[model samples]
Target: MSYSIVVDHVSFGWPDGTTVLDGLDAAFPAGRTGLIGVNGSGKSTLLKIIARELVPGSGSVSVSGEVGYLPQNVPLGAGRTVSDLLEISATRAALHAIEGGDAAEEHFAAVGDDWDVEERARAELDRLGLDHVGLDRTVGTLSGGESIMVALAAQLLKRPEVLLLDEPTNNLDLDARERLHAAVGAWQGVLVVVSHDRALLELVDQIAELRDGAVRMYGGNLARYEEQVAGEQEAAARLVRTAEGEVRRQARELVETRIKIDRNARTGRKAAENNRVPKIIAGARKRQAQVTAGRQRALAVEKLEEARERLNEAEQAVRDDAEIRIQLPGTEVPAGRTVLTLPLARAAGDDEQVAGVGGKVLETLVVRGPERIALLGPNGSGKTTLLKRIVRQGAQVPVRYLPQRLDLLDDRLSVLDNVRAVAPSASVNDVRARLARFLFRGDRANQAAGTLSGGERFRATLAALLSAEPPPQLLLLDEPTNNLDLASVRQLSQALSAYRGALIVVSHDLPFLETIGITRRLRQDRDGGLAES
Candidate 1:
């Protein structure tokens, strides 16, 4: 069978001697495939290798056609324009020069047969919801989500047979995410996207799970793959129970056989002492009993060993992660208590500007007791700025803000030290115990924040925020799922499940918002107004 991309026995390791992929073998056919895995599992690395951005230490990769890769972090310079990002600057320049009567052979050579490159680029940009973005606009002026969409447009313009995207939806807003989802649905070539976006994954033809240095392909979308895994785990658990029962039964039978053997030996001894039979005949009878007992014992032991092996195999199939579990009674707010209020700013003539988000002015806003509000808007709508303003305003109760950058922890300090810094009243053992619930145990808790991966750093930051001395009664989370993997997102959800506080979260993740039981959905308008959606 023909494959669009083939990775044959690829091996890769970092300069620090940390191995990633070891003799990995995988094939991507001509369709869209969503690559799903936990952070640091080599999904991005594999895509990089296939895109030729990074080379494998050993073995080879084969691609049938042109490959385009959109990295998780697109390099951008402030002075670079949208045209430059699309890689049509030179061609556009040449075309303009020719139009201005400088029709040099070099200009024609550059333009070639693609004179309408600019039109195509603009169309691609418009398709990705960048219709307002101009080719001459500087990259610095565009928001993070806009810049990403522009980069994607550049890739789409290339029209490569094989396209790779890593965390494409990391910085996207609701509208931008929808645009990306549409692009993924419209793609017709060999596409492999490394993302945790469930909506994006739902559009894929297949799901490939990268785990334990290998790839397992499931012939369906994310939901189907999850269903398959859940079924397998259930069967594995049942087999484990069955195997355990067999092991216990074998053990009991072994003990009973041994007891019977002992009784036979005692009987033989008694008969010999009483001279009930000839001495030689009695000795032979005793010898036969001993041999029979030995055989039975060996068979029983073998059966028990087999049962244990089956049980071990069955247990191996079940997958579980150490998730956070803690109740924060101090963080709970009363049902009718006021949590936060935004006072009116004097800048407004008749209408009071209570909050200014991206030049949009909110007349007034109030968040009360145990309310969970989802702050939603497009990128560049000033969600982050509004969050900062809210933080500055101060809450009636203790407030904790988890920024999108996850800058809550000191990089130089260990996870334990970071949490302890926020909760100075807690003892070191107490801090470590709490950190363990966040999946940082023993030496892991002692690791410097600088050394932690994206997900680990997020967890450490969260642990510090929630475990502060004065537990936060008002929690503000900004794009909490930005770079987190699916498992990490789930872990974060698990952690937040125990936080019984009033929350104001800015995120484009509608599914996550629903999961967290958002009581209200607020959208920031282009005119700088906040309204319930």
Candidate 2:
């Protein structure tokens, strides 16, 4: 029960009255902890409060030592250099000036005792797979993945007792992700990471789940947590069934008891009217019967209420994640039908230049029926460029492409409107009904696409793409799981499972690709030729 960070009676809300964490109390111990939750479950907000990036509305947080936080989105200054990001620019400058024969007191003060600051900076960068990123290089020159890695290096270089990382693996490619996983594994101080990366979570000593505005700790890693949850859910389900049966039985008994009591009263009244007994005696007997019947009815009602209460309690234990259930028969392509033909390589007699092909041209890539193809490549290997070319060239059937940025959505338009735009022929009611299957119901379906969380936006975008006007038989997704949480990843897999169409997905998430049952795996060679891996 020793702790590194403590949050007491914490409460936070936005100006728009969106309550995130309410009276939430949690403690993080000195070990690697994986923080996970569904989208918008306040995981990021809690991390920010712990990091002092945002102030909590009430309550307090205490940390045992210095804290370093790497936010989900690392703010990049266009003019800042890697040295500046690592926070050693001042010290490095002072050392350089002193070495060049400047006796300013400020230089001596800035250099302090950290004469090896430059070497330490380089070591930290190299540890995080950023050795190639020079200290003097501008941050703008790095890719998104490299920028995040550099930010992490900056935190590591600080040597803080506590480190908080929010979605640290979000933008990292496969190699960068591996390096990050290694860093997490090697950390000796208190480390808490909020991420959707399953591989990263596997390295954590414990899993802290943020759900329903509370944090629950589970000993061990993500796999252990899932096993526990699955078992708990099964037990909850059984209790619910038993509770439901009891409620139904009690309801039936209550009705029957009332009927029997009424029948007895009627019989007594008839006997009294027939003068079977003296008026005084009959009146007393009737009063006694009335009291007994009243007690009986009250008892029945109490039992019924107790049953309902038990049922409610049982239901609360179950986590109800609504599944997306939809049959898109229109999207089904016949086994013999051609879905698409993209010239992944150059054509003979065609002068079109293919980047990175190195003169090794591939034949026209043909997709038929409902084949699931995984498009794999390193960053900047022209995977996205090839996808764009395919989209521009068009498909043999109705096609839809969901790009990495999710820019397909009209920011101002509601989710309902966005989906309806794609399915112009479908009625509003029809579109909304389909959206409900994607977990957008009622006012949720009316939310502006721009205001949605990363997971919500992904769901909305998928809904729109799947529910297009002509019912796309050829679906293309680029890095679909880039920012999705684990639950959202499962949701995406479930949604794609129901999709009976040809799919070409560009992704580095091998586990996710497995879930979708990819029929073929195609790798983009360094020379730009697409080959089966």
Candidate 3:
């Protein structure tokens, strides 16, 4: 297969002297490629380097044609119009001037050969399910998911030969995700997307994983990549077992060799002491035995060292995706306990929901016991607002709210301090130990929360909530898996499994909700309407 983009010995790092990528080399074929890695693996950094959004510390990236990139966070401003966000405002203005009988040369120059820029822009936006977003509308009016789709449409309008998307599905609801997936499926150029969305990854032609400072490519989609990795891990596990046995055997043989050597020495000493044979013969035999013993001991030690090296290499092949171990039994709610109750208003019309805007519910709903609830709706359908309201109204039990933006953390505080702030009665060592279960161990617990990557910040925020006083019997999580990588999502699921409290999670990640054992699924309409699904 031919390559569309080639990264040669690329390296990048932050100003803190923290290295993200080192001597990394990767290539993308002329098709959709999904980039996968744990948080802090530099997937976004690599994409930026390729897009020239950020200069690499060393090496270079070679692309076949123009590159268009959609960053993870789409910058939104209230004054910025949709036309400006699409980046065709100038062209549109020039086209308008030309149409109004002003055939100025500069207007023609600005318009270039794209007199149909408006139509093309509209077409792209429509393709991405953003036809309702008027070009003159301010970005502040759009929902987060709408803004993302609009930004993607902006990239597609350029029609670049190479396209890079960083977590494009983030903040998007299920429908928007399908629309984005359809656009990706229809792409005809070299496209690289960094995402953990299984549905988005399923559309990729290949999977490129960044781990341990290197890039490894697997043919086909995420499922194929996972299958291949699973097989490799299974083989590695067998190798590890075999290596362990070999190491044990070699260790035993080494010990046995010493015992034999000592026994021979004793035998030789008796011969020398008793003069069982001629002194000369005895000396010669003893010397020969000593020589043989020395050789045996050298071989035994060498074998043991070799076995250990093999074991180490075999173990390296296995993945060590750390899981968050939430073991707070205090968070457990009684089976019949009422968690929270929210009143909802009546629904307006059954009109299709806008991308983000939604009405508020003013009626009533009750959450009881250790129930797991999945809150699903269009973006801005008051899901997050309702979560905040629940926290504001106060639950029957101690409640903790994890917002979509993860703004609960004090950026200036270290992870340890953040957790301790919530649990003042807990000792520093106890907080540190708990943070370690959240994958912030040792010195890592001392790092400032402001400097953490998206995944790390989520973990830190979660650690604080779980570690809070009274253990937070009612947990409200809004888009909890937004910035999390696939492994981290799995880890989150594992952690939630240990929570015996009530959970109301606002998310579009159906698979994740299923994994967490959601007991009830509720959908909120554009109005304050809440219906059980």
Count of clashing pairs, candidate 2: 1
Off by over 4 Å in 2: 276-281, 334-338, 343-369, 411-414, 441-454, 525-531
Worst ten in a row by lDDT for model 2 = 351-360
TM-score for candidate 2: 0.92
User: What digit string (tens of lDDT, one per residue) describes model 3 on residues 98-196?
Assistant: 889999999999988998888888898888888888999999999989999999998888989999999998889888999998999999998999998
What C-alpha lDDT values do all the predictions have?
0.88, 0.88, 0.88
**Global local distance difference test of model 2:** 0.88
Residue-level error in angstroms, candidate 1, position 142: 1.3
Q: Taking the tens digit of each residue's C-alpha lDDT, what string does model 1 give over 98-176?
A: 9999979999999999999989998999889899999999999999999999999999999999999999999799889
> 429-492, model 2: which lDDT tens digit per residue?
9988999999999999999998998888888988988888788899889888876778889999
Instruction: Give the Cα-based TM-score of candidate 1 against the true structure.
Output: 0.91
TM-score of each: 0.91, 0.92, 0.92
